[model samples]
Target: MVTYIARRIGAGLAILFVIAALGFVMLSINTDAVVRGILGPQASEEQAAALKADLGLDQSLPVQFIQWLGGVFRGDLGRSWFTNQDVNELIGLRLPISLSIVIVVLLVTLVVAVLLGLGSAYFGGWFDRATQILCILGFAIPGFLLALILVTVFGVYLGWAPVVGFTPITDSLPGWMRSVTLPTIALASHSVGAVAQQVRNAAFGVLNMDYVRTLRSRGIPEWRLVLVNVLRNSTVSGITVLGLQAVGLLGAVVLVDKIFAIPGIGEMTINYTVRGDRPAIMGLILVLTVLVIVINLLVDVFVSVLNPKVRTR
Candidate 1:
């Protein structure tokens, strides 16, 4: 188990390194655009040269990358070129908002998917077919389009939620929840379908196993057979789906935040991108990469705990 964990950690670290290197290289390739973004298009060559020298853009690419990586290791994510504020400070302020929405949506997706999947599998009739149709639609729709449709119907027509803007939970919990509800539903739509489908398939497969039939033939309660054998074993696949969905949820929330005008890491990212804020973009990418790695690690641990074969391996 220790060896397996170590291996996973090592692999994760390697992936982070690759991601960082690629991101850095890609950003570096657009150095002129970054300079223009910071210095403005009217700046002369001499001014650009002086600015580059001051910012260490004059340094070799390898040296700059090393410096940036060192700062990252020391928890200094550098400053944004546009606002000249610390990238860490910017992210620190916005991350919690985005993280909260992502977490809430994840919880919503989990409950909906698991219940729908297991119930549909157990019942296996109209309930199953109806949910399957819903799942197909959920998967077919784009997140942004769904967000707009939700905003149109629930926020505009039904008047159930705020049409746009976010309320911080600290200021007003109920208002915050009300503000987030539509966006959460939109962000989680794809995840709910993806996970539900995986769960249904896994549970259905487990139910067909020889032992499940044997137990059923031996007069075990159907619910017990489904719960103990089908649901329990199905969690391995379910966890896998949940983990993947969680990562995707992060990206989805960014688009949702923009559509809803929420002040979050996603909104921050879009603003930085529009302004060609390289440092902020790099910082955001690093943070996102680390988040993905950490989430995957946790998922691996969870899967290992649930499946002894994984631990043994």
Candidate 2:
């Protein structure tokens, strides 16, 4: 198990390195444009040259990459080109907000999806039909559109949740819950359906397995058979689906954060991208990449724990 986890971590680090290099190359493509955007049109050539030198853009690409990578390893994300604020500071302030929403969405998705999937598979009647219909609709609608609808109904018309702005959980628990609830629902709406379908399919396959029949023939309690044996075996697929959904949610939160005025990394992403703040944008990309890697790593470890066969592989 330790070896398996170590291998997974090594692979995750490799992926992070590759993604970081690619992001740096892509973002460095228009160095002149970045300098111009930072200094504005009226700035002299000498001013632009000095700005480029200050930002280490005047160095060779490899040199700059090495320097940036070193700084990242040292926990220094540099500073915003425009505001001169520490990129790490900005990310630190916003990351928790995004994470809070993501964590809530995943938890809700897991509970609701497992229940729906298990019920549909076990009952095999109207419940199954309704779950299928909901899954279709979930796939049909986009997350952003769902976020908009949520904002309109829950935030605007009903006044249940505040339409704009967020309150940190550190400030007030209830306020934070209210702030995140609608956004969580909007993001989880689609994830729940996808995960539920995966769970239902996995459960069905498990139920049909020879071991399940043997356990039944051995007079195992129905509830224990379903909950212990069936549920545990079915979880691998659901977990894979949830990991994919988590990555998708990282992108989906951009629109949801915008609609709800949540001050998360997603909102910061748009603001920096639009302004061409290379440092801030690159920092955001790095943070997001790391997040994706960590999430996938965690998923892999969890799957290995639930299925010892995975560890041997």
Model 2 TM-score is: 0.96
* TM of each candidate vs. truth: 0.94, 0.96
> Which residue pairs show collisions in model 2?
none
Q: Summarize candidate 1's per-residue lDDT along 200-311 as a digit string, tens digits.
A: 9888888878988899999999878777778888878877989998898878777888899999988988888877777899999988988998889888998998896886
Stretches off by above 4 angstroms in model 1 are 214-222, 311-313
lDDT of 2 by residue, 1-313 (tens): 8899899889888888898889888888888987888888999999999999998899999999999889888999899988999999999999999999999999999999998888888888999999999988888998889888988998889999998899999999999999988888889989999999999999998899999999999999999998899899997999999999999999998998888888999899999898878779889988898899899989988998888798887
Worst 10 residues of 1 by lDDT: 304-313
lDDT over C-alpha atoms for residue 201 of model 1: 89
